[model samples]
Target: MTTSLGPMAPGDIRTRAQIRQEFGGSPQGGICPSDEKKSVNLYSDPSIGEHVGYYDGWLAEEDELGPVFEYTGAGLTGDQTFDGPFGMGNRSILRHAEQGRKLRVFIRAGTIKGTATATHRYVGTFNLDQRLPYVWRKVRGENGEVRSVIVFRLRPDGAFKSSAADTIPAAKKTTVEFVQFQPITASMLNSGPATQGALSLPSQRQGAKSSARKRTTNASTEGVFVVSEAFNTEMSLRAATAASIAVRREAALTKSYRAHLEAAGHTVGAFQIRVEGLSSTLRTDLYDATSHVLYEAKGSSSREDVRMAIGQLLDYSRYVKTDAHPHEPRQAILLPAAPDPDIRVLLERHQIGLVHQLSDGQFTGPDFTAPS
Candidate 1:
């Protein structure tokens, strides 16, 4: 007789036995594939001992897009491959997106309130992030040796309820190289071979609009020491998505500050610095022509926000000098409100000024003097 399973919604709790009865899959493994329904169930248990090398949990914080759930592929030691017995779980997840298979996620909760049986909290359906599907990380294996493992990036299809217990503690900051996979189709095979070309650098300054791309040339006949253009590809994508509430607040803060500067009769603009050999470019938030100051704006006054603003101000100061401001522009940070005393001291140590908006809609900061 077919089992009649009630509707399972996001944030609902279900036990392993009930899940197996509703969805036909093994109760042992982390990845359960149901061939009859073409769906996959992903299970993550934080209670599992780390000695077993099971590092599955939600990323510490959400990005501008949304919450990211990281699931480690199956394997105990050595390099994890996608071919043999251990490969079944990893392959099922990797092909889920391309194969149009549905993914239902669950995280292990301690146990039902009054019962000893374990329960899993449903985390809603998710899909592999197209921009970055997976990143390889080195973690200790079951044998006490370090080995590379695949960590898939899964984004929720809709609303996601976050739980502190399911979040992995923030790890030491390390460079993560993301791998992007694109499905090959018949149309792509029939198309001509793709061509590679150098990025064209514009040589003329555009209008005074903040989004306009401009090329700054050295006044000296030094033969164009550096080029500055507007780099907004990533920013444009972020603006289009408008997913993260934090990102929206930051954008609003930036816009308000720009309007304040303009109202005060100050010439303000932004720049994207591009060096000859580098493919990536650095973009500044605001450049004051009247006072010759470079201001990096942040929505919040948190330590992390202040730290990022400090780095951007220092980095952009190097390339912001032009004919109008021959020397490196005085660096400063713009914030919605004053940061902590320690943050103020930190900014002072770096010789960077701080500007914050007051309740009366006025800005207060160090005096900006034209560079001599």
Candidate 2:
């Protein structure tokens, strides 16, 4: 609300961290700053089964979800409008997430000139993780950089245009535009504004009641605030695969283990096979619409390891708290065996051991009940 953005002031141009702390949150609780966002309960809440890969190890929701906004605090002075190769004007989202200042300021580019080039026929899309009603983010852009960042709160009168389009013609050589677009990490799901976003549910319900019966009933809770299930599926399955290899060479394939994790992940959200939850940097979630079971890699062969992973599974289930999908049965998979210390402990303590820290490859449990 205030201005004079030199470093970052409270209510002026607060970072994601500042907003979180101001309301009600902590730093040490979440898996990481970026991952620890509110809304989705995370690994810490004993009930949530947060895996090692997610922000706080919380499972990714598999159902259809509404828009979830992502505000970046990796401040850049100018506006590539995004965090690029260099960390210029490098503004960290939050310093001490514990202070409860873990909230990203929305972009309010409405006050400034519009750069997006939108025509009647051609319309490019920007990532609308969050559908803010009256907020805009301001950032300075160089040839391809971020600068002079500022945020403003205002109402939009239906005047939004798509920015410049990136045209990549059929390339002669393999060209991969390594744009580091941060996926809603586990931390953000567990601790970031997501939970805070939950408070809006009742109002969301009341508004739904005003609509037609079909629309009102459907609007209450089914798809009001759902995230992309497809994205969650891809990310979470990836986490399970990594854990499968880490706990043991082939723990992921054991029919019993795979079945357990398969059922558990779908219902619970994630497998709590690791203490830090799932691997943030590495993960893949797979979802079967027909079967409706989410599978996770359980590396340890010993019952103790499987039990730990089970406990983590229970954790995620508990936090979902609501019996939103009671019919769904989730699970964790622990099979095979490994020799790494982290892997061993994960198996012994949390039941997450299937993973190859150095590489993105893995094997299923001895039974080879490969994931779907």
Candidate 3:
């Protein structure tokens, strides 16, 4: 990894927009210098969320290490879970070290007590600490649900720390409301790095061997990569909760389900479809285009989870599209384990299907009658 330049200089502090404008980048695509890779990626945390409230500021404060801040990954609707070295925002920042660049962070420290346009303060440019690099913290999301989010622990490269007077001005409170603001907006998701595509199964399997299992690395056929369900959940939770546990369990269940379907010669993948009233698109967890079956995956088979998945699949089935038709796909819930008999009976009554993982990691079912 390349050596970091150090904490941002006092005079280098600037709003995310100003930094991007001068550096030639967008809120989504990430900022960089005029030269392809010379500039730093600026992360703006306004500390706003519908459920989580103004959390980024507090998380940044808890850090006793000088100039150290826990900057979150991008994704406003859910928890921002890191997807190895392939995710955007936080993961992208790590690349700066390899590419010989820097990551500058800014936090919204509302200058006035009750105002939202409060100018941001420059925290500093930091490098990820190889040890204890990240932690799963509980955070709120737009839906008011709490979930785990990956917060990267970054340390200042050189001797520098923003004074309390500079980091948080006098007369200003430490808390801020979760408000819709610039640099951190809905459109920002659309502006994510072109290289950071959504996770999905490759259209063509490398081999027909049932034992072949690997992470999907190829970009979509159109060269577009949309974020996967796990990462999406991470981004969403990041915006809502303040604490959560390991996210890999949830991701593993989904991957296991997807892999099982593929090995059986059923093409399975996450598909993006437009919802009737929503501006942004909704992605299905596992869409079998050929069979017109849509699956919603849950890490657990508890009643609460099964109920939630049922509702989501029903909602998605109504407005989702396939084969250029607004055909209601056969809806099913995929779980890590089977739910109670009552839950199964309830699902049968509704004609919603149930698929569960067996002890051996194999997926079974869609075992209910399809809704007529």
Best by TM-score: 1
lDDT of 1 by residue, 1-372 (tens): 122347666666788888766665677778887776667888887656367554565654444554567787777667664555766777677666444566678888668678888888777677665434554455565677756566676777655555555554433322222112222222332322111111111111221112111223222211112111111111111223323335445555666766676677876666544333221224466777678888887768889989998888877677666666668888889888988999999998999999898888788887664433
Write candidate 2's Cα lDDT for 326-356 as tens digits: 3533333434444345445654464332422
Candidate order, TM-score descending:
1, 3, 2
Task: Judging by lDDT against the true structure, name the best candidate.
Answer: 1
TM-score, every prediction: 0.46, 0.24, 0.43
Residue 103 of model 2, lDDT score: 31
lDDT value, candidate 1, whole model:
0.59
Report the lDDT tens digits of candidate 3 across residue range 115-209: 44344455454655432244444444666765545455555654333433222111111111111111122233344431222221111212121
Could you give the candidate ranking by lDDT, starting with the highest? 1, 3, 2
Better of 2 and 3 by TM-score: 3
* Model 2 lDDT at residue 321: 17
